[model samples]
Target: MTNTMWVRGVEWLAAAAADPRACKREWDHGEGVALLEAGRFWDVLSVPERLGLLTLDLLWRPGLPVPGPTLVDTAAGRVGFLLPPDPSGGWVGSGLRCASRGSWVAVPPPYRPARYLEWLVPPDGSGTLHGPGALEDALQQANGTLAVLAPLCGR
Candidate 1:
C-alpha cells in the first residue's frame, strides 16, 4: 500500500479503536496475536451493504498479509480479532455469539462470497478504483446498490 493509503488505514484503525463500542484482545499459540472487534462496526461504514462486502472480502481475500489483530475502544462497541481454530481457514462470524471466542466458537467457511457483494462497493474515501463512480463523469458515487439488488433478490 502507498504511504497515503497506509496513513489513511492507520487513521481509520485508530478512529475505530477510539469508538466506545470497540473491544480489544490478544491470542497466542506459543506465538503472539492481537485482534479487534466491534459489534456495531457497520456504523463506521458510509454504506452498510458495502461495509459488509468489504469486510467479508478483506477476510476472504487470498494471500493477504494478515496483520496481527488489535483492540480499540469506540462509541458503538468493542472491536477486536479472534484467533481462527485453524489459522489456514481464515475468519468468519457463523455462530459467533456476541461475546464468545476460542475453540467452542463456530464459524463459517472462508471461501463463500458474502451475501452483500451485490451492494455498492464502499468508497476508499471516494475514487473509481476505491469506490463506485460513473465512467464518463468519473464523479464519485455515494449510494449503496442494495436498493437495486433487494427487489431482484426479493428481500
Candidate 2:
C-alpha cells in the first residue's frame, strides 16, 4: 500500500478505536471479503495514551514467513498496532527458529514495554526461548519488556 493508504488505514483504525460500540476484522479469502465485527476492541485506542503495540517475532529462520499486523492494547484506554517485523530479519542465535518473512505481532501496552528485547532472552531465563508461542511465553515477554520501558516512558 502507498503511504497515503497506510496513513488512511491507520486513521481508520484510530477512528474505530474511538467508537466503543463499533469495530470489525476483515480478511480477503480470494473471494470478495470477510468482515468480522470486533465490538469494543475497535474503540480501544480512544484515549490519549493507548497506542497499540505490534509484537514482532525477531527470531526468524530463512524461508519461513512471519504472520503480521499484530494488534494490541494500551494502558490509557486505547489500542495500538505493532509495526511489521524487519524483512532482512535479525537472528536471536544459532539453531533457533528463524523466519524468512516476519510480520508485526501486535500485543497490548501494559503488555508491551519489554517486548522489544525480551523476545530473544526470557526474563526468568528458562524454556526453549522461542520468539512467539503460547500465552505463557507472550506474558513473560510482554511483562519483561514492560518492566523496563515503563520507567522510560514515564519520564
lDDT of candidates 1 onward, in order: 0.27, 0.29
Candidate 1 Cα lDDT to native: 0.27
lDDT of 2: 0.29
> Per-residue CA lDDT of candidate 2, range 1-155, in tens?
45554444434433423231232222111222222223322211111121113123422325644322333223233322222233443324222222233222222111113223111111121111222343224434644676688799993
Per-residue alpha-carbon lDDT of candidate 1 for residues 1-155, written as tens digits (9 for 90 to 100): 45565444334433333331221121112112123333222111111334333343444345843322222223223222322223233223332223222222111111111222111222121111222111111111212344466689897
Q: List TM-scores for all candidates, in order.
A: 0.23, 0.25
Off by over 4 Å in 1: 19-37, 43-155
Clashes of 1: 30
Model 2 bad stretches (over 4 Å): 1-54, 57-64, 68-136
Candidate maximizing lDDT: 2
